[model samples]
Target: MLSKRVFSLLCVAGIAVNGIGLFSGVMMIDGALYALIAKNMVLSGNYEFLTLHGFDWLDKPHFPFWCTALSYRIFGIHDFAYKLPAFIFWLIGALYTYLLARRLHGRNVARIAVLVYLSALHLLLCNSAVNAEPYLTGMIVAAIYHFYRTYREGTFSQLLFGALWAALAVMTKGIFVLIIVGSGFIVLWLVRKEWRQFLNYRWYAAVALVLVFILPELYCLYRQFDARPAVEVFGQTHVSGIRFFFWDSQFGRFFNSGPITGHGDPFFYLHTLLWAFLPWSPLLLFAVYFSFGKRRVAMGHPLLWGSFLITFLLFSASQFQLPHYLNALFPLVSIWTAQLLGNMGRLPANGTMHRIQWYSGMVIVILLCALIVLFHGSGWWVFGIITVGVGLAVLVLTRRVSPSNTFLVSYAIGLLIGIFYGGYLYPGLLTYQGGDRMARFINAHIAEEHYPDRLYVLDLEIENFMLGFRCEVPLQAIRSEKQWDAINDGSLLAIRPEALGEIPDRFEVEPVASFGAYRISRLTSKFFYYRTRDAQLGEFRLVRLKKR
Candidate 1:
């Protein structure tokens, strides 16, 4: 067993090192509000950005803004400031996972859970950029654990604590709190019959405490809708607070009636969870094994049935789907996975363990091999270089020992794959995939002295996000035929070079920049960045153009 001090130090060290590579790109959302909230803090000392931006961007609740604004005050609104909330929130999540795991099984299992979470690399990667998802996950998990105490141990203060976090969760991301807290508790009540009898006195106070904790959201609703002389939300001139709770925010998105529209992938959540809770993928596989191994024993735990039902139904029913949407259930997932790890220790680690370890190690070999093979002629060699990189990294890691050599090996291999993915594969095989060429042209020609805030995007690709993050500039996705026309009046434009064929005789091609093999001129990819001459065409960003 690891000592408390050692465990504490290891957890902190693991998370810190995991997050170090990604620290730039604070200007990602392609909107000014990311920077504006911090700017407002410095200028007006107000964290609010509704008036700052043309519209009230109250889509997310306010606590994060206050936290982020304060971070900006101290850290000066850099990538670290934007990421500080997530980092701190993730720290809470790690600690919470430790506590939850210790409760479920014991300390050994808790260590595994912490290691899995810290290595769930995507969490730290994206969490480095302040998003509602990771923070939302931390909020809901803290709430759920506190609420769990009420049902399991029946402590009144614990019930109140649960209510507090639940209220914060509701305000943070809307009705998902109900799914995390309400649905989970319902399952508990049904499974553990004693919970029904205990619900009498405790449930009432739980409700009051929840309301008290959620007062901020309540006040916002009252001030923004109910008491307002005129209120606007969900396309209704004046919104109803009651309607907003059940159907408007919760059921509305599922049915596509509340104005949230995005391409719904039936398998979106599946893949998202795969990467989000990963590095632990092998551990998760082990979890399935352990879950089935002791299925009859742990089957009745309210945590299991409730988390599964809530997370499954929430995503399965929603019209809008995003990977991070299911983050609140992560702690439950980790806790459950931890339970399997702890209980199954009595059994010897056999083929199942080796297969899990081998498959994980194999992912590293495959990715590195792909990198080496693909790096053939691109002014670089991927194999020898990557092999050396991984070997050296492994040498450094093996020097420090921890429990589960299988996990440590997996961690080292995953690190090599993930970083090589960002540093090599991206610049190699996938460089042609995005508008990186166009971004470089604008960067060099436009001059660092001239950073244009008035940006335009003609070609839409995930690569645009890459360039936007790299350049620390916001991009405006040109939506209409008219918005395309507005750019031809002599403003410098960034368009895919291959699009030159589509030019309508009014514009001329001026070469700007190149990323890898793709040139940022009038041509890149014909379908997205078609070679076009018609200056007033669709989807492009304008910097400062020269008259032809």
Candidate 2:
């Protein structure tokens, strides 16, 4: 275990690194799309309905958007404002992680759990990306923590708070959140054979409170879809947002019967955990092995293990799965891993585990260094120098303070990776994201008087969505001749290089600006290498149109 001073300093460093992401641009696809929706909500002043490209958008539930829109209202719409709420929620998660671990284990274990949760690779990335997962991560853990308190003390306030957090989790994602949140309690009760607890009035009251608290989300869905049956969504009219919320949004995805579907592999998260858990992965494996191996031991409380295993199994079985889906589980995983790490004194071959962690930290440092070299951009040399200096400082500090503290070494490495990502890698990559660049150019260079009545996007892509969020003016999609004919002279059209040929020759076009566009989220080796990056990019142009 690290001394109090050392632990405090490390925790501060971890949080400060995460704070760097608050200033980074909203990521493409999910992050930008969510920001755009929230921006539209603020503009339209209709918080009930979600709209994208002027159409009813009905994939996710409304809590995250409401939170973000409120942030926008208070902070004003910008990158930092958009990311601030989610970042705060992530901090909430860190707090709950500490509290829950301390309750189940002890102060030392709790401290380590918080560090592990902070440094987990995907959680770090998700914090910067600013998505639904960050919200869920905090809310779910809070729900579990409060519910545990309710179980122990049988207090009304604890039950109410638990339900409130659980309700928020449901609204953030869908009803499936209950499965992740409830399964642990069920398992814990069953294992303890506490059948009387099952019939406890507090448990029943919690269910009712959760339902009551979620009425806002239900009402929004009702107003948006159920009340207006004529609204077309997913290519069909008379869609029920209420039903989607209760069924299709979560279970439908699990069974691959939802409007949005994907083929899934059971082994997806299995391999994903290997990297997503980073330097902690080996220790987590050891944790699990020691907990459940031939000689079984308690893995913290049954609450943590059951919650993690049940959710992991369900996600693996579900047809719709993404890497971020696993993020909400990290808090529990962190606690379990931390408990094991703290108990290294009793565990045999602890030195071997520490050495493994040390080697893993070294590997991560090498990878981060290599990433800086490969994706060399402006200020790359400066970032490299600072990273090297920090690495050396941490090395000397850890050796002098606690020579065997591999966990600290891992945490420091994780912070370095996060700094490189938030400060250098992601921002540099955003330059290739054409929509934001084009929006910036128009905002800076294009005069308000010269601004087009409507800016049309040639295709609906992630970058274009980012443009929609960042652009001062509204963007309309142009997919057909009729839409093109609707465009007035002097209106601007943002077109991809390949689609430029599709424009009618009769519409005389003058280029205003061109930007190299790439899907920054979907990075490739070619894009990472400067020599081949141009080949990987497609050009997006802002052009003025006039009828001939």
Candidate 3:
């Protein structure tokens, strides 16, 4: 086991990396989109409705926006403020992971569980992106922990809090949280044959409390969509927000009948976990195998296995799935992985596990080093050298403290990769995100009194969000010819180069500036190679439109 001082230092290091992400620019696509929605809420002073580019938006639930808007109110609107609430919720996940592990196993496992959660590769990446998953992740684990407590102690307060957290989870995502949370307890009771526990009156009361707590979400959905049936969403009138929340958003996605859909791959998550749980995936595989294969029926905490397996299989079978969807299960996975690592001393295959971790850590470090070299060439030699020196120093120090503790080495390596990604790679990639760059350019020009009227975006969803969150003024969407015709003289317009042909011939469009653009989230080899990067980039033009 790690000493308290060492564990504290590692925890601080993990937190510092997450903080780096907090202050970084909001990412394109999801992050910026979510930021804009929350900013709209603050600006419009209408928390009941979610709007995007002056249209009624009805994709995600309102809980995350509510948290983000509250953060904006407290901290003022900016990237840091937008991401702060999600980061705090992720920390809540870490705390609950520790508490849940401690409850199930002990303090040592709890500490290890916290470390596993903080250093999980995708968790670190998602923290910077600031999506609904972060909020859902924290809430799901918290609800599960409290519900477990209620099961053990039968306290009304615990059950109430569990219901409250579950409600928040539902509000953050959808009704799927109930299945993820409830399945665990049901499995637990069935496995333990504690049939009487299912008959507990508090379970029914918890259901009522969850319903009562979620009324705010229901009311908001009702007023926004149900009451305003004339408003079009998903290109149709009479779209019900409440129905979407309970059915279309969750089950529709599962069955591929929602507005948003994806092709199902049975093994998508199975392959995704190999990287998503990086520097720890090998250990996790071993842990799961040992936990189930050797001690299946004897496993004390069936909640972890039940929740993870049921949710994993459900996501695997779902048509609409994304890698981040698995984040909610990480806390439970962490606890299980931590249990194996915490008992490393007593494990018969301790040497094999140690070697597996060491090799996996080396593989990650090598890949990250290769990426740095590939992206920056020899310019990053100094960085590479310094990283190597730090790695060697960590290995030496850990060896001296506990030669068998490969987890410390792996943890250190994960932190190093996180630092490099969060501090260097992510910010560099943002430069190619034309929307943010254009927004900044527009903000600068506005300060200089160039094209002083309010700017408009050409109805590009992702670009509009990227520019909307950063641009100082509200952006009107030019969705139709009428809206384009309504642009005031000397007002600037942000448009994609390919869409430039759509401008009326009567207007003289003079380009103010052009920005190189790429979807930083969807990277390709052509984009990564400096020699070919320009070819891969599209362009966004800031132009002044004048009537001919």
Candidate 4:
């Protein structure tokens, strides 16, 4: 029999192998944004970007500031360097989750939990993309693990650790963690009836932990107000970094109906998770089905309760939504799912219906692999087709011979999807995306020739980050009925067709280039259109619109 150490090493290898594939699917946008922000901060020497991008200041809290900015200082402002820290946090988060599960379940179950979290479709994707989610989640899981230990065993440092981790999570996002963490604590209290424990000395450590978490915000406030004192954010005339950190950034997003829009679809987030945690989505359903049949795990497993309730309710209740916000909840989903799947072994492992489902999934995966080969559009069509066909054949063989190869089948197909999407669909997609290519077009044709006075966004979001990255210029938001007026002082300007239509003054600029299909994407929904003199505009998809 292998020693415990050797078994541990094998589990690590398996998790890493699966994680690498998941991270590969982590598309560029979020990671790219974090990288860009860190680069700008280091290059411009402006650490207050928490307020930058036109003073929705304090709209986002500062853990990201600490994480990315620290990476910039150490790694010197490169995309890969910025993404490295997030990757590390992703690993750490999975590790902490394993420990937590180990404490409650067992070593075997914990190892399975880590593998599940690392292999989970959405969670793995988020790990690849640099966002505050993983960092915050890492800390949150660590805290949850310790907090439970502290409560059950009455340990001193464990309670403090829980508080500290919860605080860090707050710094990463906002007080929404209070919702997640609080929900878990309340459920624990109700279940255990630990009324006296609530008022015990353990409570003070929790308070101290929270205070320590927000220490960075405290320093930033004192530094900004005490030193510069002139800069302001979020219509407050003066920037109170602490207030923004605590409320405006965290809770503000919920209340924000500002010029920035918040989507109101109630079912938006739930549906989004189905995609984010792809391939795993169906398995999560199976796990949930199994959980209902076996009702032993309770809310004291805050990892399960907090993640589920807060994510489900917060996004559903929120006025604004994005798919990534649900990312934190996925680790919990994977943990519970792993627990559920592990338990399934005691019962009947398989039957005709189960085998049929597996066969159906294999068919779907094979078809997708075929489509990927077809769509890649390379002259090596014969080679690509043969390669993927062989791959599908291998998968089919594994499915038949190794019926326990559920994750292998899911992973093989998922990788094919992301590869085809990124390598093929992405480049051709710029015509509709108004993102990477728009700025490239400008840099190639516009920026060098005209010597525009300054860049402006012209009441539009397209070409914003692209121009910033490509031309290294921050596009000022056009603030008035005179949109693009800032750049219109007889100097050259770049304007989207609609923003150009808003100008009342005489502006005669010939069409230097018709960037045909500059921002058309297949995902474009809720189409918009506008007409302008220099550019012909028609209905366009909203998916191509700019976002932070």
Q: Candidate 3 residues 1-548, lDDT tens each?
A: 87789889989989998778987899889899999999999999999999988889998889999999999999999999999999989999999999998999989888988998999989989987778888989999999999999999989889999999999999999988898999889888998899998888999999999999999999999999999999988879999999999999999999999887889999999999999998788888878777766753224368998988889999999998799999999999888888877776666677777777776666666777777777774347766776777767766665532323677877888788787788768877888888899888777767576556467886755777888999887888876788877777777888898888888887889888998889998989878877788899998888888888
lDDT of each: 0.57, 0.86, 0.86, 0.57
Candidate 2 has a TM-score of 0.95
**Per-residue lDDT of 1-548 in model 1, one digit per residue for the tens?**
35678667766657655455345333234212444444444545544332222223335556666676787788875556766776677778878777777776678777866766666656644454346666776777777778777767988888877787777677667765666667766776676665554547787787777767776666655565566536444445666564565466666677777655555666777777777776666666566665566654233246654766667676866788866566666666776655554444344453466456656565556656654554442534644576666755654554433334555565556555545543443334333433444555556655654655645555443345445433434455553566656665444445555554544455555544344333222232232222331232333333344446
On a 0 to 1 TM-score scale, where does candidate 4 land against the true structure? Answer: 0.77
> Where is the poorest 10-residue window by lDDT in model 4?
539-548
Tell me, by lDDT, which candidate is best: 2
Model 3: per-residue Cα lDDT at residue 329: 91
User: What shift in Å separates residue 346 of candidate 1 from its native position after superposition?
Assistant: 3.1
Work out the TM-score per prediction. 0.72, 0.95, 0.96, 0.77
Model 4, 1-548: lDDT tens per residue?
Answer: 22468546755654554344332322334444455555566666777554333433344566676677787788764445665676667777888888877886777657656666665555554544446777766776777777778878987778877887788788777777766655666666765686886677776668677887677767766566535557644334565666655665556667764424476688887788777776567666666655556556411254475457655877787777877677666666767655654554443443432454356556655665555454444433653575477556646655542324554455445554444443444433333434444456656755456646355554335444444444444545555664534344444344566655554445554444434334332233222222121153232111112211
- Scored by lDDT, model 2 comes in at 0.86
Per-residue alpha-carbon lDDT of candidate 2 for residues 1-548, written as tens digits (9 for 90 to 100): 86789778988989988888898888888999999999999999999999986778999999999999999999999999999889888999999999999999889889999999989888888878888999999999999999999999888899999999999999999999998899999999999999998888888899899999999999999999999999988879999999999999899999998898989999999999998888688888988888776324336578988998899999999999899999999999999988887777677767777777776766666677777888888788898888878777766655532323767777888888888888898888877788888899888865855797567886565677888999988878765698878888888988887777888878998888889888878889999987788998888898889999
Query: What are the runs in model 3 whose C-alpha is more than 4 Å off?
Result: 295-300, 377-379, 396-404, 450-452
Worst lDDT 10-window in candidate 1: 527-536
List CA RMSD, all candidates: 6.9, 2.1, 2.0, 6.3
Error of 1 at 422 (Å): 7.1
Deviation from native of the Cα of residue 287 in model 4, angstroms: 3.1
Runs in model 4 deviating more than 4 A are 1-36, 49-56, 127-129, 218-244, 252-266, 295-303, 352-357, 370-387, 390-395, 398-403, 411-435, 438-454, 480-492, 503-548
Cα lDDT for residue 483, candidate 2: 86
